[model samples]
Target: MFDIKKITVLGAGAMGNGIAQVSAQAGYQVIMQDITEEALQRGMATIRKSLDKMASKGKIAPEKVEETLSRINTAVDLEEAAKDADLVIEAVPEILDLKIEIYKRLDVVCKPEAIFGSNTSTLPITVLGAATKRPQQVCGIHFMNPVPVMPGVELIKGRLTSDEVMEVAVNYVKSIGREACLAVDYAGFIVSRLLDVVQNEACKLVMEGNAPEEIDKAMKLCANWPIGPCALMDLVGLDIVEHGLGTLENDLGPEYKAAPLLRQMVRAGELGRKTGRGFYEYNK
Candidate 1:
């Protein structure tokens, strides 16, 4: 069995910070790396806030929060952060090219036994693996948004990913207290593909003149969904939704084409919770 003790998480955005937090809580030393100091600070702040919430709720002891926070180190240098990593999870922006570039750098810096994982929602794992020399070590470990709250993660095997690598990924996900569901490498995996269609249609409803609040209320009351489509899309970010839909449209069919309203909102920078406005307004 491959022992993974230290994790390197790239990008200090929402997904990245969440991944780092879970890994540290799982008792692994984590290096949370990003390119800028501001991003690193923001990511650390988010982690602290999440830990405080958990402590306040009695989900974890306050001492455990300090212990988990102690295991994480922030870095601005990718090479330095990855030098001794046993596993590297890249949670950068959803851009394929940017992810490929990060993998190319990680391939050179990480140790030989390091397993490379991408938290991509739509990109093919095989394509990402090809960016590095050790394709067999590359896999997609797609954690849902708000990683700590989500209980499931999609574990995708690239064309050349070894069985050993897959097992290691499954073990890692389990260690973090998340259920790992193996998925075939495809455009949107499973959850995102199915969920995107619903979200896209919700956007279409808006474009067709249905009220956002009414649609959301209907879904919540009728479908028993915890969160409505418009609100969910806002949390996921309109730009991300537009990009995922674009990928699906190219790979699946025109049926997956992004609704015009989604593209327009993304263009206008109304990116939901992060921006304080999207299909609805947020107090942030």
Candidate 2:
């Protein structure tokens, strides 16, 4: 296994910020990077809010919160943020080309031994690893959407990823209070494969005359899930849901085709909570 004490996270959106918070809370020196100063600041603010919540709930000591906050360094520079990082995680938007470009740049900038990981939920780790010089040191540590609240992390071992690298990643995630499950590099990792089917079927139900809230309630009560499928679709975003379905279809065959309703919502730019509309609407 490898040591991971310093981490660099690329992207300043919700997932990136949440991952940074969890890393900092685990006492790692975290370098959070975005393309612009404003974005970086926003991400840091999110981390601060999460820490404050922990402090208010007595989940962490005030001094510990202060210490965790201090361990984080936000920046707009990729090379600067990744310098000497023991682990670098890319949380950018889930476009294949964009992810490949970032990985190529990171392969050149990061130390030879540094472990590179992605938080991609559906993309294959092998495809992303193809962009790295030391693919053996690259893997996927797919955290759930609500990183701080989620208990599980999916550890994906690419074809080129070393066994030791996967072991190190498992240990690293465990250190941060997250359980890790190994998944094969594929169109949809285990969770996505199962969850997507559930979500898609729920959408079909809505298209067939069932109300959104009714579909959500039935699944909520029947499956004992924390939220209904529609609520989860809203939380995850129609854009993401659509993109994930496309990816799965391409990689797993027609059986994973994007549901018609999902495509229509995404085409209309109804991106769920962020857009204030999706299968449901958010009150402003």
Candidate 3:
């Protein structure tokens, strides 16, 4: 197993920042980087808020929160952030070309032995591996949203991912106080396959004349889900749901077309809580 001392996360968006927080909480020195200084500062602010929340909930002591916050370093240089990293987790945007570009750069800039992992929810792990020089060392390390509360992680082995890389990923996940589930690389994997269908169907129902609230209520009452499918979609972001459907269509069959209303909303740029509008508007 690789002895992970320093972790470099190559984005400072919601997921990237959360991953950095978890790694720092796990006692790993974390380098969180973004292309812009403004974005890096925003990510750091989010980290402070998250750490304060943990302290308030007694999940971590005040001193530990301070220490964890201190362990994270925000950087604007990708190469500097990844230079000595034991594991470099790419939490960049989900576009395939962009991910490939980042991996190509990281492959040239980072240590060859440093493990490379992606937090991609739908893209094939093997496709990502193809962008790297050390395909055997690349794997998927998908984490659920709100990383601190989510206890489970899916460790996906790509076609070229080796046993050594898989073991290192598993150990790294466990080191962060999360449970790791093994899955063969596939579109949607386990949770996304099921949730994608549910979210898409909910959108279809809405297009068929059902109100968003009513559809959500029906699902909550019938399926016993804590939140209705529309609400969950809003929480998860419409872009993510759209991407999941796109993956499903490519990998499974055409029956999984993204709902028209979902497409329209995304086209209008109403991308869930981040945008202050989706199925519901979120106030910051």
Candidate 4:
């Protein structure tokens, strides 16, 4: 078992910053890496905003904000971010080739025995593991959207992932005050497979003349779902949902194909809250 003291999060995007925040809040030193200095600044700003909100709600002590911030560092260089990380959680965009390239670089930069965890909702961990020399150390640690607020994480085992890696993933999740549910390496795994299908159907409903708000309301009220699929898809990002659907369709079948409306929305570049537009618009 590798001793996990520091965590490196590749990408300073929405998911990446959230992962870094939670890791730091859990008392793990965190390094959030992106390709540009501006991106790193934006990520830090988001983290600060989230911590401030939590502190204001009394969810955490006011001083906890600074405490958490102190534990986090930002980097533009991959090697500088990952060189000392005992565990690295990658949260880059869902491009298979891009991820494979990163894993190869991380394999060279990260210390020996360091574990690689992917915050992927789609794609297979097995393929990612094959990109690196340390296949036994590659596992999926898929945190839900808005990682700091989500309590569930999918701890996925790749074909080459070892028991030690899975155990480490579980303990890391627990330490961060989240539950880690085990899943086999597969495109979309469990949560994404179920939720993506529902979200796709929600898109179909929209195309069939149901209003997005109405659809969400029905799911929330009638099905007791925490959030309606349309709203959830928006929160997850329309482009991300569409990408995951394409991945699912490739690995599964046409049944997993993204709804035409979803593809259209993605093409329009609406995305989600990040872009201030999606199923619903947000104030920038």
Q: TM-score: which candidate is best? A: 2
Where does model 4 exceed 4 Å of error?
Answer: 268-284
Encode model 2's per-residue lDDT on 1-284: one tens digit a residue: 56889999999898999999899889899999999999988888888888889889999898887898899898888888998899999999889999999999999998889999999989999999999888898999999878889999999999999999999999999999999999989878899988888888888888898998988888778878889988998988878777888899999899888789888888898888998998887884
The TM-score values for the models, in the order shown, are 0.94, 0.96, 0.93, 0.92
What is the lDDT of every predicted structure here? Answer: 0.93, 0.89, 0.90, 0.92
Question: What is the clash tally of candidate 4?
Answer: 0
RMSD of 2: 1.3
Task: Give the lDDT of residue 31 in candidate 3.
Answer: 96
- In the range 96-145, model 4's lDDT, one tens digit per residue, is 99999999999998898999999888899999999999999999999987
Better of 3 and 4 by lDDT: 4
What tens digits encode model 1's per-residue C-alpha lDDT throughout 74-184? 999999999999999999988888998999999998898899999999999999999999999999999988998999999999999999999999999999999999999
Predicted structure 3: lDDT: 0.90
After superposition on all C-alphas, the RMSD of every candidate to the true structure, in Å, is 1.7, 1.3, 1.9, 2.0
**Which candidate number would show the highest lDDT if scored against the true structure?**
1
Q: Poorest 10 consecutive residues of model 2 by lDDT?
A: 236-245
lDDT of 3 by residue, 62-160 (tens): 998789988999899888999999899999988889999988988999887999989998888898899988999999999988887899999999999
Clashing pairs in 4: none
Which runs in model 1 stand beyond 4 Å of their true positions? 282-284
Q: How many backbone clashes does candidate 2 have?
A: 0
User: What's the lDDT for residue 75 in model 4?
Assistant: 90
